[model samples]
Target: MWIIGFLLVLGPLVTLHELGHYLVGRFFGVKADAFSVGFGKELAGFTDKRGTRWKLSALPLGGYVQFAGDMNPASQPSEEWLALPEEEKRKTFPSKPLWQKALIVAAGPFTNFAIAVVILAAFSLAYGKIEIPPVIAAVSENSAAAEAGLQAGDRIVSVDGRPLNSFDELSDVVLPNPGGKLTLGVKRNGRDLNFDFTIPTIVERDRFGNEFRIGRLGVASGPGEVVPVGPFEAVGLATVKTVDIMKMMVNGIGQIITGRRPVDELGGPLKIAKFSGEQLSLGWREFVSFAALVSINLAFINLLPIPALDGGHLAFYAAEAIRRKPVGQRSQEWAFRTGMALLLTLMLFVTINDVISLPIFSS
Candidate 1:
């Protein structure tokens, strides 16, 4: 079940991500040397009429596309790239205008985001959107809200000066601020007021005993109604949801880097497989929803400013634009090498974290 779920969830997402790059590069007249789903040894593949080797490789964690005149799948320019004949150079990725190169590099991550938005939109269409009022119905004793002098019947108008239309928006602001202070704009008895307090942190445990640290204001919302939305509204809501998830990811990573969150909170492929299998067992809806979350995660990770990733290439392009020339080849090579090493070390750490959190190790 685990193996099946992992493959089912990751396979299409990774393939489409690479396809995004391939399609855009092709559109710009850049010739692709190879398109691979996965890394390492090639398990199965075939060459196309355009001489592009489309292959399914052994490792299935991620994938890449190698453009003409590229050194490897990472798309670093080959040393021999400059020596290529004029006709051949024209087809290589490096020969493209700077803007075109940036678009090709960015297409992969944006494609993942698009996939997530589509999935979420489908879900919204199937099940009406949940619309909850921002009014506070109850406040937990001694909780953050109570400590801040909030009471039942208080209508939350905003958080930290940002206007809130629904209770759902509150979580988007609060969840990412564990142990952080926040200001709340409230309306009570038709009078406007403001309250400030530190959000309380709580450790939550799932049925499987996995623990998560989160922020809690300890206020209960009124029972929300399901409001049917049109297709356009569904897409808009899905886009908002995707952006919210991305924001949470950014906050979570910032917390980890600042030592506000434990490093063990980070998980790699093993953890994903475990969750994927569990969600698959639940039903198709759960499984597909999990896949959407993973898709957004992939998009966010690849957009980080790290070398050997899409964002890294975009970073170099930005530098090129500023200086009006490509960065020195030696500098790019060394930066890529360093970035690859950092990624590998982080992967190893997260894998170890996942393994130790497994049932067998826990027992």
Candidate 2:
């Protein structure tokens, strides 16, 4: 079931990502040699009229589309492609204009984001936005809220002068400033009241043993409203959600790099596969939601300006655009080799982290 779930999560998303590259390359008049799901030896395949071999491979982890000029699945161009006949050169990927190449490289990540947006939108239309009221259900005894004179049934209108949309909005004010004072504005019996209070810091460790400090107001939220959204509204909301997740991920990465968060918080394929199985056990909708999250992560990771990624290709294109020529082959080769080494190291570290986290292996 875990294997099935893993495939279900990665299969369509990877296919769509490759399809984006293939489509854009074709649109730019570059011939694609193969469109493959997974790497290595092929399991089954068929050739189309355009002579592209579409194959399902044994790995079933991720995929790539090889263009006519590509030396490998990594989309690196070769001297063979450069030395082609004049007519054949026109059909090769490297012969395309800078903008065309950029678009082709960018399309893979773009497709992943597009898939996420669609999935998120569909979920919004189905289940609607979770709208928990800002009202306080109960203030914890001797907690910050209680010390601030917060009462049960008090409706929070704002925190630090910022308007509150839901109870979760309080985290925006509190999480960043542990042990710092905050100004809370509440609506009690048709009257506005403001209180200044200090946040109590709490240390929390995630599944991967990463520790973080957060503040707790010690108040439970009231009941929530489920507001159904229209298709267009859902799409817009999904886009915002996508952007917000990306921002959070970026911040999280920065935090890890700065030693504010642990490096073990990073997850590789094993962690994701476990999550896929867990989500699948819950239900199809749960699995789909998980898949959407994974798709967004893939999109975000691929767009990092590291060599061997789509963003790396786009970066090369940008340099080419400015210098009126591509970066030298030797330079590109060294860049990709370094990138591959870094990527492998990251994967190995995260895989070890994942293994340590498993119940069978844990202390």
Best by TM-score: 1
| lDDT accuracy of residue 126 in candidate 1 | 87
- Model 1: runs farther than 4 Å from truth? 72-79
TM-score of each: 0.94, 0.87
Question: lDDT for each of the candidates?
Answer: 0.90, 0.84
Residue 331, candidate 1: Cα error in Å is: 0.9
- Put down candidate 1 lDDT per residue, 136-221, tens digits, no spaces: 99999978788788899999999899999999899878877798888999999999999997878899987657788889999989
lDDT of 2 by residue, 1-363 (tens): 668888899887888898999999999898988998988899999999988999989888788888888775345567787678999889988777778888988999999999999999999999899788888998899888888789999989988898897886776567755666788899999999998877787788755443567778888887788999999999999998898778778867876787766687788878788778878988898899899899999999999888888888778778878999778888888889888898899889999998887768765
In candidate 1, where is summed lDDT lowest over 10 consecutive residues? 70-79
Q: Clash pairs of candidate 2?
A: none
lDDT of 1 at 124: 95
Alpha carbon deviation, residue 181, candidate 1 (Å): 0.5
